[model samples]
Target: MMAIRDATAMRAAVADSWHRSAAAGVLAEDSCAPVTVTGDQLRDLRDAHPLARVFPLLDDVLGQAARDCDAIMAVSDEVGQLLWLCGAPSAMRRAERIGFVEGSNWDERLAGTNAPGLALRLGRPTSIVAAEHFRHSVKQWSCAATPIHDPIDSRLLGVLDVTGGDAIVVPQTMGMVRAAARLAESELARELLVPSRPDPGTGRGRIAVECLGRHELLLSVDDGWGQRGQVRLSPRHSEIFLLLASAPRGLSGDELAVLLYEEDGGSSTLRAELKRLRDLLGEDLLVSRPYRITADVTGDWLAVEAQLAAGDVAGAVRAYRGPMLPRSTAPGVTRLREGLADQLRSAVLHSAQPDLLSTWTRSVWGADDYDMWVRLRDLLPTGSPLLALAEGQIGRLDREIGL
Candidate 1:
């Protein structure tokens, strides 16, 4: 087992990984690079990949094993994109803080020196311990991983990783992950021999609308080939789309007119706008008689709401980009904007993790939020690096309020 406290004592392979990570310009203190794929793009990648066939087996093996330990078992494709992660709920949450979730890229170029990335790079079993990790954000973690190869041709398939605290670097845990990787390879070989079933969800259009910040719409069609392009929306069309997205049960034209124009007088204008919107997004996507989005559409605001509802406040904060349609003054849009901002602010101020609070304080929205700053200041440890920023904000607030 490699020692976490001393880097000079590391094995030659581990030292070489650190050199490669440095050459890639990966910052030691920075968070992992931003997610490479999300939403529809991620779904399509997962569905089309050969590894998807072995997910159930991986889950059965890793999920059961992880329950008794404070670790997570992660599978990543050859390029180091995470395909699946399962572990103790608490450990999963901790991992997410540094962007270890599914669909994230953990390539050495992206996440710096880590077990999975290095194992894949070296084509062998590897271990990365605390402080040995190139990223400071992940120094608290240690992991062991091994590469899985295609059984027939011995082509590199992916990597299987077991990540946790200090226990991860222990010889027994390292051997266990290696054994699991071999088992996964055997399962994948068997699965490849059988004809695969068609995914029912394939070829379906996925519509994602973003109401936070600027209003935008993304329509991805699978077409049984692969995911395709996005359709941009006019601001007015985006407004209508948001209203319809909110009321999934459907909203009458009159009700929509009132929300859009704040009076019954603009029913004609509403109808005209609806006609144009229908022309842009296929008629089937926008059902008439009652104004509602017929196709499955997910909004960024809805993502935040869902995370909040699921009691994952950190996830909710991560999902919330900004206020809903920052430029829209439509009565309905304004209501949603304020309501969402208020709910998120309250949630964060009440129960946010310290790291999340630090993240919020750096944002434009929270930079001037005196109350949140006060709470964050109180929660921060004395002499912490962020204390100065929190104090500065509080002082600015005091001057503004003439305290």
Candidate 2:
């Protein structure tokens, strides 16, 4: 109470967080009510989120540390939405009473000043002991948390938290959470560094391309000295590479120009773009009787397509990052994006597991998809937290479409 009264005397981070929460109109005596998403919606959010990629690694580290302790391990996305929670049954039950469950929105603005929320807000490790929390209801608990970042770009990925009674306030607990976060970041970095296996008989070393969200090209020699860095492609380069990779026979300059620019210009523009691409990729890697990549490149989009072809709807959804070159308006790129999106959307709508449908609806590409949201809303159990989200979206969609 004294700390709350004289927040200036508190640790700078905690004091700042408290001040921010108050300015955001968070009431100290509020119930700290949870705004949660549950059931299929919860499962979907977890599956599609990039943070999901690190869960297995995080579980291996923090799960062991949490055993037999009163503390629980919680992970939240960059926005401070709780994604996963693990701990003793009794501890979990206690947590639930305070609405600290999976899929709950716990950002400082919503949940008041606390460790996970403050850690995310401050972009650093933080701790909040009992009586320091802005919400009176949460003051009985203590928590330590650290922000996790994407190793490649150093962008905040999520927050890792350990929460319990006063035990969580100890320095050792804060250290443990920070170490666990570092291990997770290391795992993410290692994944990016490793190259996928080369296609047989390609004879051009290991080639991997990511065209799902961003464009990245990686080539590793067969001699085991893999390239230490990746080449990022411009939008035009990405479009050209995707087309050439899809059609091994390749296209003539005129055909390529039409597909890329939506009109027939002479081969001059095509030649210039090709020249730039050649400079970025070695000249030998791109051949020109008809424009084509000399080597086979296994792409993230191709992997997703293969997974869908194998009737692995869940796997396909997992592989899909977003619409290919979402900002590109090239005719061929637009066709490919629409075709792939329609195919994946059909598969998810028709045969995806309930959880997968939820994921698709929550995804950036599918969030505005009305039919999927309707389907998910119907499938969710009555009174589920996600039902509200689906309903809200449906209502907005109804207004937009004049339904």
Which candidate number would show the highest lDDT if scored against the true structure?
Answer: 2
Model 2: per-residue Cα lDDT over 146-205, one tens digit each: 999878646577899988886556688888888989998888888877875643443464
> Which pairs of residues clash in candidate 2, taking residues 3 or more apart in a chain or in different chains?
none
Clashes of each: 0, 0
Give candidate 2's error at residue 160 in angstroms.
2.3
lDDT of each: 0.74, 0.76
Q: TM-score for every candidate vs. truth?
A: 0.50, 0.67
Candidate 1 yields a Cα-based lDDT of 0.74
**Pick by TM-score: which candidate is best?**
2
Let me know the TM-score candidate 2 reaches against the reference structure. 0.67
